[model samples]
Target: MPGKSGEIIDYIKNDLERDPQDIKTIVVTHHHFDHTGILDKLKKITGAKVAIHSADADYISGEKTQHGSLFMIPIVMFMKIIYRSRPVKADILLEDGDQIGDYRVIHTPGHTSGSICLYNPINKVLFVGDNLMYSNDKIEGPRVVHEPENYKKSIEKLRNLDMGVILTGHEQPITSGANNRLDTFLTELYD
Candidate 1:
């Protein structure tokens, strides 16, 4: 973090009274530029280990360009113009069932090849990163997916979990009744 962006560092020091070094790991949910744009810079400042799913590690490592639909080309380019992507290697390659802190990694691929959801069984909170959306009292799937079949399976996988809270990558979080919201969404999705 440099220039105006260093405010994150400043906030940590001034508000939280904590050092950037306190950060131990940077967990990335996918390869989207919006999620990983400043990852390289942040990693440098905090000296944190970068963790990303193995399927998407190459994109973060700059070994391969992000794969997406043709419609996303323009959106991706726009992201590049607004926020430059700085590739950084992942220190830990994660997979399904891996535990990061108190969260269990659920590989819900579809939105991206390595899209994931972090489930905390203790709190019954699920962190669905772009694999699902919650807004206007509704739970919806991603608008676009790289693999439609995988997306359906991912939704099915979520159905088996006992989720009370849903923290989404975008839109407001579903703070309660997460299971019911997901059920309604699934019904609508299938219909």
Candidate 2:
């Protein structure tokens, strides 16, 4: 699910309310509004550093427009007009294989030209942001892609990895045997 700002703030507030001593870090897989909506608020509330891939840095820094579909143009225009663009700066710019806490950055672009995934080797969890989705016990490739070839390559890369849990940005989260399902989907793409 796209982490909205209000929801994210509430989530952090609840976390801190439960344990004020806990360390927090908001790891955004990309700069999409849905993923970044509460980013600034979460950073302020938890005093957590925001991390994003360097390839998307320009877009987040307000230097470039966010890549969006033609269908999303009206909504983007509305957001630009109604909401003052509070350009967010990432505390840490990530690179492929870079570690954030227990998670490793996986540059899986194509969904937005700068998309990424977070993989935790110990937990075997893959936090894929829109690069992949789960539905009906299956792993589905991206619904939209700015670069189809790159997206396909990303899916193949992820399929090769050892993952047990697939936490997608949308739809239900897959808890077990996710890697196998993802591999099947990738293989089918070739056939």
Candidate 3:
């Protein structure tokens, strides 16, 4: 939700010409440093309630620490030096099937223990944060290796959803045939 350098707050206040305080809530997909780089600052400015899955709430709040894979150790250390995660206390603890405004929270844990996807049933749009990525004209799973079993199951759950547009945390969105793109990604995953 928060871009690096906490510029998103400025964009919301200046470019969007809106009061950050009017924001009802801030939804966090996970507690990864990249996703949460500016979260604490944003919350302070917006005075918005923070919502995150229970599994990751502690880590984000600085009550617990996160451990990455052996391969990610260096990357995590670098993030610590560069980004310096700020602790955030979640006002609302989310779970699968929970509704936040018009979006339904779908627990898609793989990239992180509390990773989630927000599906808007009315518009049929899904915001998948790092659970799936758009790459090379194809839909793909998380780039980093985490919980493969959970990742596969998460993708399968998405396969059952009636999605129109697929928005991801990074890269371009899949505007058309989201299910088809997901299907292709699934096939690749299973193979």
Candidate 4:
């Protein structure tokens, strides 16, 4: 969520330019700083209900601390300083198959205990938060350090989806044959 707050605000208010009153909810896929950089401010400006998976609700609420590996401590500290994720309570606690509007929440925990992906079956669009990533013409697990077993299980769970396109939390979108790519990643992962 760490970026120029003004740019994000302008993008939401001017680029998309939707009425603030019309924007109802801000969905967070995980508690990571990169994805939540401007969350606090964005919610303030849009007055949207903040939704997150229950497993990570405590992290954002400042009720629990995020513990990472020794090597990642400094990096996490730096991100905390840079992003300043202001603690906020979650308005909605999502679980697997929970529907919010057109999207269905998939609890894909690995990169974090509460990592999630939103799948819109009607549109065949999957909003996959860092559960997976695209790199070097290949779909792979999260680039960041994560819980390996949980990540694998999460991928296996997602492999069932008949997705047309995949929009990851970061980087380029997979616009064609996303399910195939996921299959390949799964096969490679299990092999």
Q: Across residues 1-191, which tens digit of lDDT does each residue of candidate 3 receive?
A: 33454467677879999988889799988887777767887788888899999988998887876667787667765666666556888999999999999999999888888889999989999999888888888887677746776888887888988999988988898998888888888898888
- Order the candidate numbers by lDDT, best to worst: 1, 4, 3, 2
Q: Rank the candidates by TM-score, best first.
A: 4, 3, 1, 2
In candidate 1, what are the lDDT values of residues 1-191, reduced to their tens digit? 11334777798899999999999998889988768877877898999999989999998887988777788778876766666656699999999999999999999899988888899999898988899977788887888798888888888898989988889887898888888888888888888
Per-residue C-alpha lDDT of model 2 across residues 1-191, encoded as one tens digit per residue: 22355564556468556542243666778877766654555566567777788988777677877777888867865675565546678888888889887888889878876788888889889899888877877877777787887877877778767888888897888888886788788888788
* lDDT of candidate 1 at residue 114, scale 0 to 100: 89
Work out how many backbone clashes candidate 2 has: 2
How high is the lDDT of residue 162 in model 1?
91
List candidate 3 stretches off by more than 4 Å.
1-6, 74-84
Candidate number that wins on lDDT, 2 or 3: 3
**Candidate with best lDDT:** 1
Q: Estimate the Cα RMSD of every predicted model relative to the unseen true structure.
A: 2.6, 2.5, 2.1, 1.7
Which candidate has the highest TM-score of all? 4
Candidate 4 lDDT:
0.84
Model 2 clash pairs are 1-169, 5-38
